[model samples]
Target: MHRLITVALAVALGLGAGSQAAVPFYDTYQLQCRANFGAAFNLPAGSFFTSSTPAINNAGQVAVNLVNVNVPGNPPGVWFGQGGTGQVKFVAADSNATIGSISLNHLGRAVFPQNFTSPNGVYFYDAPSDTSGLLTTQPIGASSFGTPIVNDLGQVGYRVSFLGSNAWVSFAGAPPVAFHAVEAALDAASPYSFLFTPSFNNSRQIAGKVRLGAAGQTGENRPDQIRIINPDGTFTIIAHDRDSDPNSLFLSFDNSVALTDNGWVAFNANLFPAGRGVFFSNGVETRTIAVNTAGIVSTIESFGPAASASGLVAFRAFENNTALRAIWIGDGTTLRRVVREHDIVPTDLGPARIDQHDASPVFGGSITINRYGDVAFNAALTPPDNNQIEWGSGIFVALARTPGDVDCDGDVDFDDIDAFVAALSGPAAYAAQYPDCRWLNADCDGDGDVDFDDIDPFVALIGS
Candidate 1:
């Protein structure tokens, strides 16, 4: 039966009658973090994460911002730790300053804005050297700094707001350079009047949203645009408000955009006609990952879309007609739910429900995904075993499974061959055969598909 199946598959996929080239084998390793609510790092008792957004690097290091709610006058601080390890250390804390959103790079370095401080500026903390310092002070004539994102090369990108102008700047251990500034001519016909949500990738490319036209120009309802500034200082518009084009599907985009190293940008936007959804584009083509529908979701949260270099997108959205929310990951064709509100999560303390509080205004949790597919996030949890000790909000990482593990049995072997073939048949057949496994496990090449192209890679995993 195995021989017959192999011959049929070879014939169907148009493989010639010859020995196939040796496909590189990717070693299967257990993820640093488990699917359970295992904390990436432990927080002090009674401390809660203030910012739901946590950043993760490809090395499985996680960083977050939190505050000690039990201590009066206690300052919020940024913390860093390795996934699935409890050894966590503080990056920075100040009683007189507030820490903004934190971004981490593969070097274990984190960058964030230290607000309300003397010489308020964006700061960096190097975990290996145990050192922290300011990266750049506020640009002259700037009122504040937006969230700063650090790339692997130690370059930082952020938005600076002036009295009446805003600009996106990139810093590389020296003076900052403004790549795009308000009142700068976007084209011969208009100037960019507004910029928001600047992001950086390893290629030194910057992506963000912009409004074309003069600042405060009346009767100018030009839709916002998503643009990228390339390494050569050239610009490319990924998507824009093209309401006049009958073929354009996007009506308007929200203020959130996430850029991946592979030059893909993920965002949330209002769809044409009426609805909201999460979509991604690579400057040439755009694809939808999820959209609000009657029974699936009522609204997709605009603030929590994250992209990965492996061509995956993660997002948060509310369940239809319910307050419950869920985190989902997609590769354009396949969507998987990572977790949801009220789901039980097993922790070091015990099992707890993924919960939220009315006091916390952040509707859905913030999320981030790395090149390796690991997702780091922050969430409030109901105390395990009804015990509040050492419990409140926590940072966690959901590590991705090894490639070609179609059965998701922790290892790739002969046991997965049938399931792999089923997955190649289609997602429905794969799910019908392996209800608990993910169809994405068959995406061996990591090109976001399960087809004949993955056959050699899958064979390499189990040996020729």
Candidate 2:
């Protein structure tokens, strides 16, 4: 199985020889799924697969869950996988008594439970050194925490359910504050409202949803409304009326939200409550953006920073079962469908089934759109199994960033160009030392080369 995937990758790379600029989007462990490396890694017999709700840092470091390789008499422990090299490591010996949550920051640092909910044994893995630290050593005073999301600054926000109570975010040092649930009704039995961290930016701003009320309620129940909260304790709510039927029975709201360092918040909502596809971005003006789908599923299993200052929302969208799922990027006024997988060849692949709600075959994992409209997500592809189609399927195909290096980090865009010219002009050895700077940078002007044509922005930078 692994060899076949690897052969496919060899063919892909060979076919891509002409476009030296094209870089594969994903790196997967083993042959369980298709990734850039052509499926070299695989789980040992007793080792098991983890759900692909992966956490990715700005450094492209991703942390995924794993199960230990079972021996005749040994017990299983929780494990985490590294992105740079697909290295899977156990939290520690005696740490595998039970499984809990795992998180990784942009620096590739991780926090996990040595034992399920064992407050004192929470360990953080340093990506650089591959060392683990006891959470008790950190200043935060919490016995147990989960669902951690970290920014580039190493600021971690996690749901800490401490002392037999509800959960909230605890900063590294300060006393943990219970995250307040969004209250829409102000009065109702249990009211039933809550919010969790979906994505955060360097500015300390978080984009997430607030579920307000159950299905049938007075005035209307807004499930999955996009909201933003600042570090200063201020928040604004953004809701889209999808059903539009002033008296409709169901009120489907936008479930996905993302933010840019530049203070732009983007969301997909039912443009007029009639529930057609319309996007909304909050920058200088609060207005409807062009879109064709109804709305992005409220459940954004994965998310990343926005790719543009002009406010573009990128996400995977689907209509229902029996349809194609495509990656979508919306720049308020224009929408682009960037990536799609080929249909299964009945003779070679066999029949395919789709779930009703999601419609897509694979579970929706995390997604991040870089500043240039390049979208990244954990997608699925069938492995070459003789008969078994459903259970033996693998779901981790990463796609190349679209538009070819808009932000350019060896792979693509403005950022790559800036870094390339800065390195080249600074010292003679810059290009030689950082070959990726010269070779991997994006050629936006498309002059068949990534040289002076790509460095015009840098020339302006130097002159300024």
Candidate 3:
């Protein structure tokens, strides 16, 4: 029998060794955690309530706002969750009762409030050095560094809501220069409504929602639109359909918007009660995703695989209807339903409801997909406490397999490599070694063959 061998297999092996698929986000960290109290972070059994903001950095570090309710009031400080090391560390401590909610960047620097009384400002905590850097301390400007989103370039996006004017301020470099805010020119309804909801990508394009009016008497947001601000303070509204909906379009500002390096923004918009569909790669022109129709009307918790270095975003779009729940993979333009038999429970926030104090039935707490098309999501075991019960739910994180997954398992491993090898290997080859191999590119060592160079690495990293 003529044994078929792959040439330049070693070079292909080297190329495949450190290479990752083009995903929107990577699954570097995953855990099923449960906080003790109604709090965010589970700190010991007694003592401090450390509930972290849901924001996570590319490094898998999470920002935790430590509220010591054991002291009688809301005394908040900032903390960091090093997901890689399983370390939940304190970043900054508020002594004068000045700090507010915490925000962190991939570099692990945290931004919190600083109390000085003259020019109240934000402080950055360098967790690596345990030193604090003050952005501002005077109250004359009395500006806020609220809702901060930082990138690896040391550029920080914060809401400077001051003096009846709400704008976005991007701070770049160490000892950031006295950068002014990006003031979006509104057509005059209410100046206070211009809350700059920013999603900063590596390209320095800060995209966010700007409200047109103040909170309505019905407790509803009057009207708002999406806009993008470049580094030089120039901007253009990407989805400001003023003539479209009467009640405006986007509902919630938090976690309702996302941006990618490819000038793409993952947003939720409505075709006037066709209900809210989580749209991805929505540029100047509105685009609908291919998720389940039921999920289109439901609240999608997270978006993923993450923007690969090549700018591909992968995420499981979760939808919960009164009767059915489904999870789908959402690329920029297409959403492919992955699983339809998922059972969804309401989150801490309840079942998905339009008006009133009810929680949206969510498919999961948090969702992320890696460049390898590996899907991950956090699901709630207990229904949200909108019913006001003290029963805390267990948040379990799960993962899904990708298309190149030749083994049909939730991960890429030796079986997958073997299957890939078998596909690349011909009939006259050693078929017994990799009968199921399907991925031809995985045959790294070539020499017209698939051997240990491919199998060892694939088997060694099943959990990675």
Return the top candidate by lDDT.
1
Instruction: Rate residue 378 of model 2 by lDDT.
Output: 43
Residue-wise C-alpha lDDT for candidate 2, range 1-464, written one tens digit per residue: 33453343344334323321232232112212222213224333444433344444444455555444344433433333433235445534443454344556556676654445344444666778877666532324445454555555665544443333223343544444434332333224433344444445566666565555642343444444565666544666554343233542225544445655565666544434344344444533654443343443222223332334545565655524324565555555445545544433111123322111223445345445433333434444443332233333222323333323333432232233334544434334445555422233333344434444544543332222
lDDT of 2: 0.43
Pick the TM-score winner: 1
User: Which prediction has more favorable TM-score, 1 or 3?
Assistant: 1
Task: Estimate the TM-score of every prediction.
Answer: 0.74, 0.61, 0.59
Q: Which 10 consecutive residues of model 2 have the lowest summed lDDT?
A: 27-36
**Of 2 and 3, the candidate ranking higher by lDDT:** 3
* Candidate 3 lDDT tens digits, 1-464: 11222223332344344323311222122432334455533343222322233444444455444443333343445444543223234423344455554555667676765443334566676767866666653323635546565566766666665554556666665444332233443223333345555666667667776655543212234455666667665666666533324564544433346666567776655444445555554445555554334534254434322333323344444445443344555454434544332243333333311111224443333333323443333333333323334333322222332433444333343345445545444443534653432243344343334444654444334323
Name the lDDT value of residue 180 in candidate 2. Answer: 32
Cα error, residue 201 of model 1, in Å, equals 0.8
For residues 198-272, could you state the per-residue lDDT of candidate 1 as single tens digits? 888888888887777665642236657788876445788888776434467778888879998878899998887
Q: After superposing candidate 1, which stretches have Cα over 4 Å from the reference? A: 1-41, 67-72, 86-94, 176-178, 183-190, 218-220, 231-233, 243-247, 320-323, 357-364, 383-391, 402-464
Q: Scored by CA lDDT, what does every candidate get? A: 0.68, 0.43, 0.45
